[model samples]
Target: MKNKMTSHYAAKLLTASLLLLANYAFASDIVFICHKGNALNAKEIRTAYTAYFDEPKIVDNKALRPKLLQYLNMSEHQYKKMWEKQYFRRALTPPVVKKDDREVVDYVESHDAGVGYVAEVPHGADVEVCGK
Candidate 1:
């Protein structure tokens, strides 16, 4: 009985360790993605998506906001605070297409101009990593 209990505990520990490692790898591997042809850099993405900087280098079109903020390091409250300021200044328009990572991948795959972020390294032909 003692040996059996020991083996069960050992197995549980190994399983827990594997799960933790997998979670870490997934989080560490997540990367920002965009349309293949958008030609956007991190600064442009930040400016276009959020009012992180005033007098931001002009990028032609703006997309969704919260999703982009989620992509970046900003929390929802932080994004909202910045957005309120930008709204008063009339500096930004929210994005049209709201998509999660998989949807972003699907959209980017189909539309040449579609842009979005992913939680893992982009692998498809139409997706590009906009930021690290």
Candidate 2:
């Protein structure tokens, strides 16, 4: 009985460790995607996400925001605060928040200048990856 209990505990620990590692890998592997018609590059993607771009329709994936913030080395509070400042100063609204990658891909497919980041591109999403 003791050995069985120990084995179960060990398995649980290993599974938890794997889950953490998977989340870290996913968070670090964000891909910036845009409409096929746009030519936005990596630098522009970074600037558009961290700074400002008034042209492209920006879509923020809520499911990927934690990973995005981790990649940007920003706390959730800081991210929201920065956007608040942008709104206050330049009246630049933050990106439209979507529930997941599917919504973002759909938006980009429909909008010519749409841009967004996603954890995984949907299988049939008619979008192009512009940045890593």
Candidate 3:
């Protein structure tokens, strides 16, 4: 009986571990986004969202912006004010899509120039992960 109980607990532990791993695997991923027409870059992404720089250099046509607007119930201006306290002065372009993070991921995956925030661990080849 003791062995059986131990085995059951081990199996349950394994199952829990697998579920945790799967949760991580399927979590939403955020990415920086911009108009396909914009000539932004990754450094811009760090600057725009993080508010840690005056002028972040662009690399490879990407832009960095925050992904929490909808959740915060705020407009771009409010977001800017919060960031400006930290020193980001650049004008922010509107998000390419109006939908949520999942939608952003779908759009970013399909559009070559579409960049946005995502929570999923990027697989490369499809969307680029900015700001680590």
Candidate 4:
């Protein structure tokens, strides 16, 4: 009876692990989008979000903010506090927050200095996917 219970718990744990892994695998669909002429690699994208880039106007989708913050290795509250500190120091402007992926894409397409992230890179959006 003990062996059977242990096996059952192990199987359940394995299933849960697999599900978490699957979510992470699919999360790679996020692509960083920027204006057609602007290009940024992953490192540059990270720097841009952290307020190191002055030329590009950063935008973020509210729906994806938490995931993007996770990608940046910070929680949402931590990110906000960091940006607030940056603003207080007069170092950089906080990123413009948008409603969703569509709005982010639209803002990026319309502004030459715009940069944002979306779940998928849309076809002919007049923006380039700089990083994933």
TM-score of each: 0.47, 0.75, 0.36, 0.84
lDDT of 3 by residue, 1-132 (tens): 999999999999999999877755443234454434443565565454444433332222122233344323456688657655544345533334434445565665565455456445334434455543
lDDT of each: 0.56, 0.84, 0.49, 0.85
Residue 39, candidate 3: C-alpha displacement in angstroms: 9.7
CA RMSD of all predictions: 7.1, 4.8, 9.1, 2.1
The digit string of per-residue lDDT tens for model 1 on 5-53 reads 9999999999999998875665445455666655567667556657554
lDDT of 3 at 124: 40
Please list the residue runs of candidate 4 whose C-alpha ends up more than 4 Å from where it truly belongs after superposition: none
A best-first ranking of the candidates according to their TM-score comes to: 4, 2, 1, 3
How big is the positional error of residue 72 in model 4, measured in Å on the Cα after superposition? 1.7
Output the lDDT of residue 93, model 1.
43
Residue-level lDDT tens digits of model 4 in 56-120 = 88998888886787678787788999889888886688999998888999999999988999888
Worst 10 residues of 4 by lDDT: 22-31
Task: Output the number of the TM-score-best candidate.
Answer: 4
Question: 2 or 3, which is superior by TM-score?
Answer: 2
Model 1 residue runs over 4 Å out of place are 1-29, 52-73, 96-99, 109-113, 121-125
